[model samples]
Target: MPVTTRTVEYPADGLTMVGHLALPAGADRRPAVLIGPEGPGLNDFQRRRADALAELGYVALAFDINGGRWFSDPEEMLAYVMPLLADPDRMREIGHAALDVLRAEPRTDQDRIAAIGYGTGGAIALELGRDGVDLRAIGTINAVTTGRPGEAAHIRCPVWAAVGSEDPIMPPAQREAFTAEMQEAGVDWRLVVYGGAQHAFHHPTVDHTVLPGVAYHARHAERAWHDVVGLLDECLPVVSPA
Candidate 1:
């Protein structure tokens, strides 16, 4: 099915967030998935993911947490995202605001919502799960854990997380710790580590030259994307289009 796209604006912590919303053509209501960006704000990567989700008969919203801004450099992006990460409440607020926007869509099934995020965006999605948002499933790629002890226990939905096995930023130890915490919390979760992959493994634009520490692995990216889609399909089962 063809995808219809629109720009939406909503209030978020006194700032107006402008996001891109994509839905499958036709008027049938469908499960919605909120797609969050890696850092700074909305970008082509997140937009593409939203469009892909729409093709799968979902109403997907790519949220702009940084008010529609983008940074080509990693340092600049970190400068913007760091402060937000420091404040747990702000992170939760941003996720909640995005979730609200996704739910408010006329063609979205509010009760059957899911969220997927990458990097910092992934962390935000995890925060939403930790806050007990009514999401059916949550998926995170190259996500950063809350680090704070026992944070995983609060998550109520099933989670699917993927990270590059060779990623220096999110190393095997961290992944192990996160898995341990999830197990302790008794949360339904799956952790996948892609061998030889590095940070931001799903971003097509990412290259070793531009971001010295990051390398995008196409194979792992494709596999991880399918895994995420499968998880959503299982948890948020879409109604057949009439």
Candidate 2:
């Protein structure tokens, strides 16, 4: 199926967020997926993911966290994202705004949507699950931070998280804590640790170093993507019409 792409502007967190929407061919409703960007905000990388999902017959929306801007400076990006991480309510608000945009689309199957995010975007997706949103599934990469006490109990769907074993930001202790929270909450969750990979291993290589411990691992990136697709296939499978 051919894929179509467009830019959508929506209000969120006191800024006009610019999201990239990709639609699969045909007017019939399809399962929608939310694509969240890394800490640096929405860029060509995430937009391409949306397009790829569309090509696979899904309605995908790559949402923005830094409104319409993309930050190449790690310090500048963290200065903005760090505060939001502390405030779960604010992150949920941003996720909900994008969800609203996605739900409003005529081609979306409201009840069969899933959320997949990377880096900071991954945290947003997890927050949405903690907020008791109706999601078919939640998948994230490299944002394994634990949520507020008892909040994981609110997650009503299966959760999948992935991280590089050598990711300093999401060390063994942090991953253990996150898994403990999910287990205690009785939520269905799974975590995959890619050995010998560093933080942001799923991201493509950049000209300059974005942050310490952040590097791209081509092999691990592909494997992680395959696993995420498997998660969606199991939880939100799209059946073809006869």
lDDT of each: 0.85, 0.94
Give me the runs in candidate 2 sitting further than 4 Å from their true place. none
Tens-digit lDDT string for candidate 1 (1-242) = 47989888987856888898999978988999989888757877788889999988899999888876777777887788888877777888988998888888899986788988998788889888887788899899988575456777788899899998888888878898888888898989999889999998988854323555688799999999999889998999888865
User: What lDDT score goes with residue 156 in model 1?
Assistant: 83
Q: What is the TM-score of each predicted model, taking all chains together?
A: 0.93, 0.98
- Candidate 2 on 1-242: residue-level lDDT in tens? 47888999999999999999999988889999999998888989899989988887789999999989988888998899999989999999999999999999999999999999998899999999999999999999999988999999999999999999999999999999999999999999999999999999999987764888999999999999999889989999887655
Model 1, runs deviating above 4 Å: 206-209
Model 2's number of clashes is 0
lDDT of 1: 0.85
Task: Find the 10 residues in a row with the least total lDDT in model 1.
Answer: 204-213
lDDT of 2 at 183: 98
- Taking all chains together, the TM-score of candidate 1 against the true structure is 0.93
User: How many pairs collide in each candidate, listed in order?
Assistant: 0, 0
